[model samples]
Target: MESSLVLEKYAEKNRFYREITEKILSGKTLNFEEALRLYQEGDFYFLGTLANVVKENLHQKRYYYTINRHINYTNVCTTNCKFCGYHKKPGEKGGYTYQVEEIIETLKSTPELKEVHIVGGVNPELPYEYYVELIRKVRENFPSLRIRAFTCVEIDWLSKISKKPVEEVLTELKQAGLNSLPGGGAEVFSERLHKELYPKKIGYQRWLEIAKTAHRLGIPTNATLLFGHLETDEEIINHLLTLREAQEETKGFYCFIPLAFIPEGNELSYLPGPSALKILKTIAISRIILSNFPHIKAYWVFLGVKLAQIALLWGADHFHGTVIEEKISQSMRKDTVVHLSKEEIERLIQEIGGEPVEI
Candidate 1:
């Protein structure tokens, strides 16, 4: 694809192809759709160059890494959203909630880990006090560890259950040592497509509102798009815009994670998997459009190692976690070993010529 094709395709978009080609040759920001088009049409040379330039520019060939552990505080979710593989039904054998002692025991043992990523089901029965006390106790016990916990969905559910304003709950959590919010459950942010995938769950706009509220209240949060699962190009653009608008308003979104939908033992079983090209295009486009956020992550667990490595050049700056016990999404795909050890994670980041930086 020539420079003109991208410019013509994204005429009104602030960062068009002509500007992108000029920037590429002169070394500036990338053109979003041109990169998307490259992913669509397989422009290897262009994609490779983009990755190398962006990666080197970001870190100068140095990859930073951190050791972290994943602890599912609980798994009993009432909003058993179809796309999720983690939620446990009432009578299901695996339905269990973590006692305060269990989570404390797990945290105390892992002294080497610097971060704790906590996310689980939207179980209304799990009292709001469980979360508040958990954060307070964890912070009091391990003052050094950064607690990157909770999804926007969890915050929404918790607030509604507690009958308190969103800001007040977040304020209490922050005081108790809540660090950041994860970008999970953003499964494709289109009104039409979201209804098909997660009709029973909270609205997509509610997710954005909570995320925005978190950022404004001094909490940094990551956002994601679960693409390649019955969504169209128009849907993708719309999703990006919603996130972009939030970024513009709060300037607190830390990264944009383009998640590849896993289709094993799930509702969308017959859907074909997304190709590497499609994945890379989405990543590049995310980086280009969500220009306000600093990092565009290429998550290894969801996309697999090979694609994540290749995506380093396509405007992706971060390769998300060094999860010791990542099991939720892994349950969806029988063959995937969801938990990636720190060393294994470093190997992949180093292989791609990108440094994994610690928070």
Candidate 2:
């Protein structure tokens, strides 16, 4: 009876996107051509309505969040990603690296932190032990804490420095209590953007390879795409489809996060950022395309709390976390607010008629 009611509601609500909406409701995966049509031609409300159908179908009313602290252990980096405003040279005035003790002390001082999000610039000066011991010490200090740390780019860098395979590096980290891999460092995957935006970092294929390798090793990972920069609609579609193909094979990705590129302090500062409508459309399209992905996060750090709240209606089920000190987004120094406490985050979710879920 409940299923019939949902089906009737879906049928009535999706008239604007009847063809594609029917296909989605029938549990058929959309093809690339159809996805392109939705991007080029679908109504914003229709697309969002379709996406919300999928979201509620998968997760019901439970919107997920976590009590996590972002620990950017170092600002000293070697890569020259043009979109990055966070990395600094070793001798730069603001460059800093936290000792293991400092990280543990920060965690100890903070209360009810369920997860620790750790990412940093690719600093060659830090020894292999620095990376290994960081995870070990954190695990020792907080045995129950979930550590969602490192990007594929960072993992590739570690593989280079430790002279080990990506699998080995991930294995050691997992043994040291690494819970999962965060999806950062995956900007747009176009070759043109690669040349202009992040020539130094590994390309999309290598990033995908690293992610698949991690999944094969039983390490759950998240995937992301940074949009609203110098990428065409086709390139954005290509990025989503590529991740969808990956998820089909491994079934390891936990969530898909669409990061809006903030061009305030970076080399791309001259370009305009994505509008709120475009952000919402991107979220909706991501949900429509990456059907295999179980979650979509509207990262409140990049998207302000208000916009992130709006994203829940569009299709996003996750709102990142409390993010005590989100340095990467903060480093941009844009006109963006940073960090929301658990209470505040809950209130924001409730205001949108969403049930804030923690796990």
lDDT of each: 0.75, 0.88
Q: RMSDs, each prediction?
A: 4.5, 2.5
Candidate 2 lands at a TM-score of 0.95
What ranges in model 2 sit over 4 Å off? 1-16
Where model 1 places Cα greater than 4 Å from the true spot, the runs are 1-17, 23-48, 51-56, 62-64
lDDT by residue for model 2 (49-94), tens: 7788789889988799999899999999988788889999878899
For residues 80-141, could you state the per-residue lDDT of candidate 1 as single tens digits? 66667777876678778888778889887875878888888788668899999988888988
Q: In candidate 2, which residue pairs get closer than 3 Å at backbone N, Cα or C atoms, i.e. clash?
A: none
